[model samples]
Target: MGLGACSTQGPFEEKDRGPDRPVDTSHVPDAVPRHEVRTAAGNKNPYTVLGQTYHLMDDETGYREQGIASWYGKKFHGRRTSNGEVYDMYAMTAAHKTLPIPSYVRVTNLDNRRQVVVRVNDRGPFHGGRIIDLSYAAAQRLGFANHGTARVEVEIIVPGDQPPAPLRAEEASDAVAIPSGEQTYLQVGAFSTLGAAEQQRERVSGMVGYPVVIHSPEELPELHRVRIGPLTNTTEVAEVREQLRRNAIEQTHIVKE
Candidate 1:
C-alpha cells in the first residue's frame, strides 16, 4: 500500500530520505503468475482500516480495475507486511485493499503503454482516489516513480484451478499432511542480495529457534530465499507460524518445494 499521508509528505516523513538511487534493472523481471494457495491470513471479509470498511472478494477471477496508482518506498522497506513477509520495495509486488493477499496481477501504465506483472502481497492505498499501490521498483519500471502517481490498469491473472479451501485456525492443529510429492515450506523472506538474505535468516532462526535454510535457486540466483522446514504436516506448520507471530514476524507464505 502507498504510505498514508495527510499532505504531499506522507507517513514516514522522517524516513523519506530523498530520491531513491537508480539501480540495475537488467535483472529485474516482471512478476510471473503461478498457481498458489490463497493464504488464510489477511483474507477476512469486511475488514476495516483507518475508519474505512473494505470487503475482500471471495474470488478474484477476471478482476480488473482502472484508476490512480501510487508507489511506496524507503520508509516501509524491510518492514513486516500484512501477510507474513518482509516488504521489499525493489521487488515487483503491490498492495491492494481487497484482492487475495498472495495473488498476481498485471499492472499497466496507460499513458506510456508500459506494462508489468506484480504480485499482490499486502493491502492498502487508503488515500482518496487510488486503486492500487505499486512497489517503488515497479513504479520505476512503469516510468512513474518520479511522478508519484499514474493512470493504470490492474487485472488479476487467475491460475488454472481455484485455490484450495481456506484453512481454519483450529483445523491447523490436526490437519493432515500433504502428499510427499507436494511438500511445502514456509517462506519467510526473499532478498536480491545473499548477505541481506542471510541476515534475515539468522534473525528469524534466532527468534523462532528453527533451522532456517537459505535457498538460492540455480535459475534465479539473484533471489536468495529464507525458508523454514519442508514441514510435512500442517500441525507443525501452524506451530512454527505461531512462533513467528509471537516474535512479530508477519510476512510468510506456504510454498511448494
Candidate 2:
C-alpha cells in the first residue's frame, strides 16, 4: 500500500511538557491486580466491519474535540490487527474507527493538564463514549492507568491546508458510544523478546494504577507486547491519552483493532 504523502508544512513544534508526575496506585480500590485477570472477562472482542454505507465530505480537513478516553492491553498483544500489523499494547499508540491511517492528533488529559501526540494508524474503541484507546505506556504518561479512565480532549493536526472533517452527525450517531465494550481497539509495541516487553510493562506498572500485561503475539511470534484496555468511549479515550502524555511517554500512535 502506498503511504499518502504528508505535505511539506510548518515545523513540528514540541508542546510544553511539565515534570514527570506519578499516580499513586496503592490507594486504588477493588482493582484487579496486575497480571491477575488474564483477559478482560465477558468482554466481547468488537471490530466487525458490517459494510455500512459511509459518506465522504468534500471538506476532509479540520480539527475536532471529543469526550473521555481509555486504553487496552494484554489480550490483543501481538495479534494481527485489522491493519495487518502486529499489536503491541505497550508502545505509545491508540485506536480510532474512522480517522485516516497514520494521521496525527494531540491528546490532552483534562484532569491534570497533560498532553501527548499520537499517530492515527488503526480503527476502533467502538464501545462508545471513548474517542481513543491508548496503550499501557501512553496511559501511564497521561496518568490514567491509575483511575482506569480520564476526561480528554483530542484535536487533529494535519499538514497543508486540508484537515480531516469532523465526524458527521449521522456518522457519529452510527458510531459506537460509551458503556459498550465491544468497540474496535488499537495495540502498540511489538518487541522481539518477552524480556523487553516485560521491561516496558514493569516501567508502566510502577508509574500508574493499572498493571501492564505481556500478551503473546499470534502473528508476530518473535514479539511480545504490553497493553491497557477495551475502551468504547471516544471522549474518555481522548482525555486519557492527553494525561498520559503529560506524565511522560509521548511517542504514541492509534492502531485499529
lDDT of 1 at 101: 81
For TM-score, the strongest prediction is: 1
List per-prediction Cα lDDT, in the order shown.
0.74, 0.49
How well is each residue in 1-257 modelled by candidate 1, as lDDT tens digits?
A: 32232233332232442134455332456765666677766576787777778888887786999999987777677776677677777788988888988888889899999998889888777767888878877888899877788999998987545354365553455777778788677888767678888899888888765578998877666568789988877787888878986875645777785
Error of 1 at 73 (Å): 0.7
**TM-score of model 2 relative to the true fold?**
0.44
Q: Quote the lDDT for 182 in model 1.
A: 83
Query: Model 2, 144-166: lDDT tens per residue?
Result: 76555689997765543334335
Q: What is the lDDT of candidate 1?
A: 0.74
Q: How many backbone clashes does candidate 2 have?
A: 63
TM-score for every candidate vs. truth? Answer: 0.60, 0.44
> What number of clashing residue pairs does each candidate have, in the order they appear?
5, 63
